[model samples]
Target: MMELFFKDFIMLWSTIDPVGTLALFTGLTARLSKSQKRKVALKATTYAFVILLSALVLGQIILKAMSIQLISLQLAGGIILFLFGLQMIFSDPEEGTGSREPGHQLAVFPLAVPSIASPGAIMAVIVLTDNNMKTFTQQAMTAGAMTSVLLITCGLMLIADRIFRVIGHNGSAIIIRVMGMILAALSVELVMTALGVQRWMS
Candidate 1:
C-alpha cells in the first residue's frame, strides 16, 4: 500500500511540479502588494483544489457520456497544455497588468484554472484513476496524491514573493521556457500514443 501511494505520489508530483508553478505564480502576482498577493494565492489554491477534486470524481463519466474516447481526450488535453506552455514561454509576464487596485479579489482565472487546476493536471488525474489498475484504495490514493500536490503548490505560492527575490524574473522566464519544451515533447508523445503507433523504435 505504501509503495503504491509512493508511486502515485511521484507520478502526480512530476506532472504537477508544484515548485515549477511557484515561479510562474510569483511572476504573475508580482505587481500586487504583500497582503493582496497572499489573499490571491490562498483564494486561487482553494478554488483550484475544489475544481480538481470534482473533476477527479466525475471526469470519466462526463467523458463517457459525451461519447469521448480516453485517447481523444488525452490528445485534446495535450494540445491545450502545449498551447498553455507556449504562452508561458513566450508571453510577457506583465501583458495583462491587472491594476484593479490592491484590495481586489483574485481567484479562478489566472491562478486556479490555468495555474493549479491545469488542463494537464485534470487529464492526468483522470488517466491515473483508470480502472485497469484495480482496487478502490488505489483509486483513492490517486485522489490523495492530487490533493497533496495542489496543497504543496498553494504553499509555494504563499511564499511567492520571497521566492521571486531569489530566482528573479529572468530566471523564472528561463524555467518556463524549459517547462514549455518538455510539455511540447510530452504532448507529441501523447498524440502518438493516441494514434496507436507504439514501438516506433523498430
Candidate 2:
C-alpha cells in the first residue's frame, strides 16, 4: 500500500511539475511589485487548489457521464502535455509574457490555468481519483499533498527576485527544457498505456 501510494505521489508530482513551472510563472510575473507578486501567487495557487480538489472529489462521475474513459483521458492529456512541452522547448522564454499592458493581471489566465492547474494535471487528478483504486481517505491525502506542492510552488515564486538572481535566464531555460523532455516521455507512456501495451508486457 505504501509503495503504491508513493508511486502515485511521484507520478502526480512529475505530471504537474510545479517546481519547474514556478520558474516560468515567476518570470512572467516578474514586473509586478513584491506585494502584487505575492498576491498573485497566493490567489492563483488558491484557485488551483480549489479546482484540483473539486476535480478529485467529483471527476469520476463527471467523466463517466461524459462517456470518457481513463485511457482516453490519458491519451488526450498526453497530447496536450506534449504540445505544451514542445512550446517550452523551442519557444523563447520571453514569449509567455507576450506584450504586457501597465495593469495586466498575471493570476487569472495563463499562470493559473495552463501553468499551474494544467490540462495534464486536471486529467491526471481525475484518473487518480478512481474509486476502485484506493480508499477515499487515501485520495484525500493525495489531494492534500498536491495542495501542499502548489503552495510551495507559490512560495518559491513569491521569492522569485532572489531565486532568479541565483539561477538567471539560462538556468531557467535549462530547467524548462528538461521538464519538457520529461513531459514528452510521459506523454508517450500514457499513450502506450492507453493502447493496452502495458497489459501485454505484464
Candidate 3:
C-alpha cells in the first residue's frame, strides 16, 4: 500500500541520510582530482550498498541466533543513532582531514562504514523487515526502498563537488548539524515506538 511504501521510504531516507553523506564526501575528497573524486564516490556507494543489503538479508537470522528481541534491538538502535547524531552535530571539521591523505582507503573507512551504511541504517533495515512481522513481499519492498535511497546517495556524491562549491564548507556544516537534529528526533521516535508509547496514547 501507499502508506507502507511511504513509511519505508521515509525510514530508509532518515537512516541513510544522503545529504549528510554528501557533506562528508565533499569534505573527505576535497583535495582529490575530479576523476579521483568520482572513483571514490562510486566505490564508497558500492561498499555501502553491499553492507546495507547484506544486513537486510542476514540481520534477522543473526539476531535470532543471538536470541535478540525486536523491541530490544529497536531501543538499542535508537540509542546508538542518537549518539551518532550528537557526534555529527558536534564533531570537528578537521577530524576528517586525515582522510585526504594519500593511499588512505577513504571509501571504505568513514565513507562506507559509519557514513553511508551506518549502524543506524543496518538496525533500521532489520527492524523494517522483521521476519516475524513482515511478509517476504513486504521485506522486498523495504529492500527496494533502501536501494532507491542508496542510488540517490550515489547520485548526490557524484555531484558533490558542484554542490560543495555552491554551498561552501560552512553551508555543508550547517546542513550536517540540521540533519543531526532531525536524526536525533527520529531516533527518539524510534525509542518511543519500541516502548509502545504511541499505542498507549492511542
TM-score per prediction, in order, is: 0.73, 0.66, 0.68
What is candidate 2's lDDT per residue for 3-93, written digit by digit as tens? Answer: 6567667766776677766766655555556676677778777777777787788888888899987667667766776786686678776
Q: Roughly what TM-score does model 3 have, to 2 decimal places? A: 0.68
Q: Please count the clashing residue pairs in each candidate, in the order shown.
A: 0, 0, 0
Local distance difference test, candidate 1: 0.71
The per-model lDDT (C-alpha) reads: 0.71, 0.70, 0.79
Poorest stretch of ten by lDDT in candidate 3: 95-104
CA shift of 99, model 3, Å: 9.9
Backbone clash pairs in model 2 (N, Cα, C under 3 Å; residues 3+ apart or in different chains), count: 0
- Model 2: residues >4 Å from true position, as ranges? 1-5, 71-105, 164-202
For residues 153-178, write the lDDT of model 3, one tens digit per residue. 99999987887678766776776677
Model 3 lDDT on a 0 to 1 scale = 0.79
Candidate No. with top TM-score: 1
Worst 10 residues of 1 by lDDT: 101-110
Best by lDDT: 3
Model 1 agreement with the true structure over 101-171: per-residue lDDT tens digits: 54233366546765567666777778778766657788898888788887888788887777667776676
